[model samples]
Target: MSDAERQRRIAEAAYHKARERGFQGDRHLDDWLEAERELDRQEPRRP
Candidate 1:
């Protein structure tokens, strides 16, 4: 997928993660990074 699409997916994943935790403390960055790692593992970038 394109960079924009990838970013959108990550953002959506992060949002869901945050929502899952009741949108508690300031963990946006952690959620985003976790999303990125999950996505990357699912589909690694091309060389």
Candidate 2:
């Protein structure tokens, strides 16, 4: 996928995670990083 699409997925994941956690303070950055990492883990490698 394109960079924008990747970003959108990550943002959506982070938003959901934050909501699940009750939208507490200062977790958005954590949410984004965790979401991105989770996505990376699920993606297949070509090399």
Candidate 3:
């Protein structure tokens, strides 16, 4: 996927994660990073 699509997926995942925790506190950036890591883990690395 393109960078924009990857970012969109990460944002969506982060939003769901935040919602799952009741949307409290200031963890949006953390959520996004974690989501990106999770997505990265699911895909094979490109050389």
Candidate 4:
């Protein structure tokens, strides 16, 4: 996918993660990183 698409996916994943935890605390960075890792593991990007 393109850069924009990849970012969009990551954003969506992170949002879901926050929702899962009831939107408590300040874990936005953690959620975003976790989401990126999850997506990368699912399908590694090629350079």
Error of 1 at 17 (Å): 0.2
**Residue 9 CA displacement from its true place in model 2, Å:** 0.2
- Report the C-alpha displacement of residue 21, candidate 2, in angstroms: 1.0
Deviation of model 3 at 30, angstroms: 0.9
Better of 1 and 2 by lDDT: 1
Worst 10 residues of 3 by lDDT: 38-47
A best-first ranking of the candidates according to their lDDT comes to 1, 4, 3, 2
lDDT digits (tens) for residues 1-47 of candidate 1: 89999999999999999999999999999999999999999999876
Is 3 or 4 the stronger prediction by TM-score?
Answer: 4
Off by more than 4 A, model 3: 45-47
- Taken over the whole model, the C-alpha lDDT of each candidate is 0.98, 0.89, 0.91, 0.98
Please write out the lDDT profile of model 3 over residues 1-47, one tens digit for every residue.
77788889999999999999999999999999999999999974465
Residue 39 alpha-carbon offset, candidate 4, angstroms: 0.5
How many backbone collisions does model 2 have?
A: 0
Model 4 regions more than 4 Å off: none
Between candidates 2 and 4, the lDDT winner: 4
Q: Candidate 2, which segments miss by more than 4 Å at Cα?
A: 44-47
Model 4, 1-47: lDDT tens per residue? 89999999999999999999999999999999999999999989989
